[model samples]
Target: MKNLRNALLLKQLYQLKQLGYKYTSVTPYKEDEQHLRLPNTLDSLKKQAMECHLCELSKSRQKVVFGEGDPQADILFIGEGPGTMEDSSGKPFVGRSGELLTKMIENVLLISRSEVYITNIVKCRPPNNATPTPTQAHTCQPYLLKQIELIRPKIIVTLGVTAYHYLTGDDTEISKVRGTLHKQNDYTVIPTYHPSYLLRNPSAKKEVFEDLLKVKELMGK
Candidate 1:
């Protein structure tokens, strides 16, 4: 009986390992109960996200990047996930990619970075900055959804393939869809290459520039 119990325990642990969990904890409430407990307001929600432990990403993350910028902004920029600098500083888009994004906003859009909101699909950084697993993204989806509800931006610009995929549920290649506008309920979602991608392939800057032009035009009406 003892050996059988030990084998079962190992099986459970192995299952968790396969799911990308580095740690686990017992919670007092069910998943729905915990989710229902989340506050509605942005500030209150941010505080809750700071203390979030819904998934294993929380174990490795240095901080939970809730989001930043004008809550009432007409535009919201969504990225795939956090990176090294973001994890350390708890701010989205803060390194070279961040600088490029800032430039895009200021130069192309003719607005300051603070005029728009920025965040990631997943609040926490994945291990070694790997793409967030589906489970992790699913765990964080409610938070992002609530943020969208509160912010209610007129436009949502997805910064990469991952952001575009998760937000719109469209598996279309970003190259094929980039710069195209898709209506999501009330808001207009514009798919674009991430700033990080531009950093590696500077040639794509022109393409993103055109996309931003479309966003700017849409903002006018």
Candidate 2:
């Protein structure tokens, strides 16, 4: 029975990939024609992300925050895109939202924020905090996929509708997505509201915290 269920699950995942839902991107992050040595780890991803011209974002970007945190972390947090502070610092989630994320991370599993990898679906900061268009996402996605495959994280926590949408292609609302674990490309995925969202609506923290607890349980922490 377990084997049958597993087969069914694998079939569904393949269907999603075939339909351009969840996929493993193999393309380089850029077509620079000037190859930069990409590190096999997150640290190297940052270097490539900065020089990446996979999309027009590189043209106006101040910094392409590749990612940060423990490379071998069991947990990975993926966000929608970079914001002002992130761009300025060339780091992901360094603002108030990052602070909230840090606290939430600590609350779950006794792990510090520095102990888990944090990145975004799109590496570069979108113009004026705008959302990443489909074309941009297409260009940047391969890099993210590479990161996931390299880290082989045990859990992926997507923060916001955009990240969830691109990963699962299900237009389900964030409220519906949060607190429920989903599998994508063989990774355990759970979507939740962006920390920035929780800051605006503190009531949502309850929901975010609950989601964190789920991650804790999954980690056996």
Per-model TM values vs. the true structure: 0.86, 0.81
lDDT of 1 by residue, 1-221 (tens): 12223323444565578989888883322233343655768999899889988678889999888899999989999999999999999999999999999999999999999999999999999998898777677678778888898899999999999999989989999999999999998899999999999999999999999999999999883
Which regions in candidate 2 have their CA more than 4 angstroms from the true location? Answer: 1-39
State the weakest 10-residue window (summed lDDT) of model 2: 1-10
For model 2, how does the per-residue alpha-carbon lDDT over 13-41 read when each residue is reduced to its tens digit? Answer: 55456689756554322323234234576
RMSD per candidate (Å) reads 7.6, 8.8
lDDT of each: 0.87, 0.79
Candidate 1: the clashing residue pairs are none
Angstrom error at residue 52, model 1: 0.6
Pick the TM-score winner.
1
